[model samples]
Target chain A: MFEAEVLSGGFSNPAQDSARAFRACLDAMARPGRIQQIAGAVPPAPLSPAAGAILLTLADATTPIFIAKSHDTEAVRRWIAFHCSAPVVAASDADFAIGTWDALQPVSQFAIGTAEYPDRSATLIVECEDISAPTATLSGPGIETTQTAYLPNLDAFVANSAQFPLGFDCYFTAGNQLSALPRSTKVEAL
Target chain B: MTDQAYNFAYLDEATKRMIRRALLKGLAIPGYQVPFASREMPMPYGWGTGGVQVTAACLTPEDTLKVIDQGADDTTNAVSIRKFFERTAQVQTSETTAEATVIQTRHRIPEVALTEGQILVYQVPIPEPLRFLEPRESETRRMHALEEYGLMHVKLYEDIARHGAIATSYAYPVKVEGRYVMDPSPIPKFDNPKLGGNAAIQLFGAGREQRIYALPPYTDVVSLDFEDHPFDPSKADHACDLCGSEVSYLDEVITDDKGSRIFVCSDTSYCTTRQDEGHTGRLSPEGEAA
Candidate 1:
């Protein structure tokens, strides 16, 4: 049953791929702003290596995920459902959402968490074509000194960070490359 | 070889390592609450998941384990917790205090004095001493960094002013060493005095709050009280019906429908041991079974 669910599609060996993806999650969370490339699963079209890696890493029955796009096809849904059993919900009610930034509409709809519990915020896994070094400089608890990421938009991230420990954390996935921006990070536009 | 079917002690090794590292830091600091990324267990919050996690990390094959809830070994929660570790870690279980190397408890410390080589793990529902005062984590983090604990002091003073005695009954707050004012779980103030100057190491875990704190062997733990008001670990001024012990903490039991109260020792094992030796209070009828 585990093989039929986790190994059916493109990933011939699900357990090994899941382990690699989990390592990427640990690295992303531990280092805050550091980008780690994660590749293994050969999921169908829209679901790239980085996106597939994330689904394997964080998605489980406990986590609520949302997929928002016409491109969110049945093959992608079947693979995730069989492997993780993660319930799919609307964008506003998701703990983690996957899609283009535009389809995820009004990022404020997701949970920013309460004043008492900031860690309750949602984590967005946005699919991108390529991730490069943006002009914005980043520094926080996890960073050794300072680093930069080419973000989809500086204004959205700057506004998000202003809330401090009360905003959504994001993971930008392009092909097998993934980078993160925790709420604690300070993003300054150049 | 590890049982590939289950993770180490039923927790992933990475998670155990993270908790183990946090435990070491907590021990070294002595009373400071270290923040950890606590995981969700099959059990509900407000239960003893925190204590379970700590026990899981510290358990070795050679260690004999004991678990208690409200000081009773046979309590349902305690029994369930013991069974979980037994199945996962395959460690030996014990009811005797002296024979056990690790004891996990909720709401009360054991009556038997723990010596060196023993570890007492407290199941904490909430580990923050200042959580009620400041609701926000951002504010509490700053408060801890600055050592601004006047709010806690003011709260205690107000309790005396209103009730003519400190109103806090269990889970009393205490200062560890000289740095961190820690919550001693929900054990009534009566057990507060036993916290400090003990030969055993004490650990506190609050899973929902994602916190782990400790008090090393012989560390100073002062119960929060004013100079004039003073702290008192007060209990019902009655002796145990089965054990004749007056100093042990008591659990108030209602014997009759009219609300007649009988004070019994909270430590069930200790009481049973004493009863076996023919100890009985004046209230217990002669030749009555324990």
Candidate 2:
């Protein structure tokens, strides 16, 4: 059923492309608010290049992915199965989740990890229409002083930052551009 | 084992992804030790297996890899690891501190200032700061959960009361971003100063402990100490006898049976760079006939 979808828009060079994509993701998280360009994967509709690249680079059998309703199309699910083999799990069970800001509502259902193993939390790959301009001031570990970037909702992010070592991280993607806002970053709307 | 049978960088994609995920989490919470499924590598448990695995995951076709063991690139661990990646990943390896995109270190961050985009991966034997004071894993986990670090402070205090100074030198505890008190591997206390506000992204990995922690560039890493007794980054009083370096951390070398000793820069790359620039110390090759 998914033979045709498997052959399209996947990394041409898995070794190099995934490596570069991962580097971009790493850069995005390590230095929050800094926009990094990522490419090398073109999934079915609704999945941007940056999001697809992230899924291809990070998702595997070990990681369970939750596709939100906006990105819950049959083509996207099949592509995820063919490319990464990550189980499509419930929101709470997801190690990673992908969707737009509105589709990923009631974010409390996702795992923020336990006090013991806080790193067990989910990482939401948020697909945005565009990633540019400074909407909020970001300051924390990765940032030297303070940086500003456009996030979907600042209040939600500020609340997430309060969780510290227990909150889920976010990767904001638009087209081939990407940025991240880990829980460690303190977000305040400008 | 056939080299061709191994995947890129020696680790299969799945394992790399697992490690990569752990790494992102580690970076997200600076200095917090994140548990990972540590794999058994071709090498033994103690000799930089964690750092190697981390480096393998972070490495790409475009990266220039560098490996150092106790500040020297020519050591056994460093040479073997560099060779391991060269054969497995076919990436270029360098001895210069500034040249490498990823530097896998077993103690001793390079003396030279690291720039942005460079990643420093440390081989950590013990990733937990409170492991010595409280041996039980469960209790330590509870202490961390409660943000209880009194035991570590008491340990440091006892050392000061006993020796008139913080007796601990290496593997010194540091609080990252005012949160987790982390063990910065076995790097000397003198090197601890470099841990804070450095441009390079610092990553710590312990294969035996199955833990990985990180310090993103410019992260605040405060060495644990009391208010009256501020943390002092101390080194050998003598300068590098070969390179005439005064600021760098020095390794003492016994020259003769008569108790003649000379201090040399622990960082081989830094020392070589200085020496190549015509800097000479008391025991430099052209300075004295030893």
Q: What C-alpha lDDT values do all the predictions have?
A: 0.75, 0.91
Clashing pairs in 2: none
Candidate 2: residue A85 lDDT (0-100): 91
lDDT (Cα, tens digit) per residue for candidate 2, span B95-187: 999999999999999999999979999999988889988889999888888889999999999999999999999999999888888999999
TM-score of chain A of 2: 0.97
| Model 1: residue A8 alpha-carbon error in angstroms | 35
* Prediction 1: B-chain TM-score: 0.95
lDDT of 1 by residue, B46-115 (tens): 8788988888777766678999999999988999888888887777899888888889999888888988
Q: Candidate 1: list runs displaced more than 4 Å.
A: A1-190, B1-4, B283-290
Give the clash total for candidate 2: 0
Report DockQ per prediction, comma-separated.
0.02, 0.86
Q: lDDT of model 1 at residue B208? A: 90
TM-score of candidate 2 chain B vs. the reference: 0.97
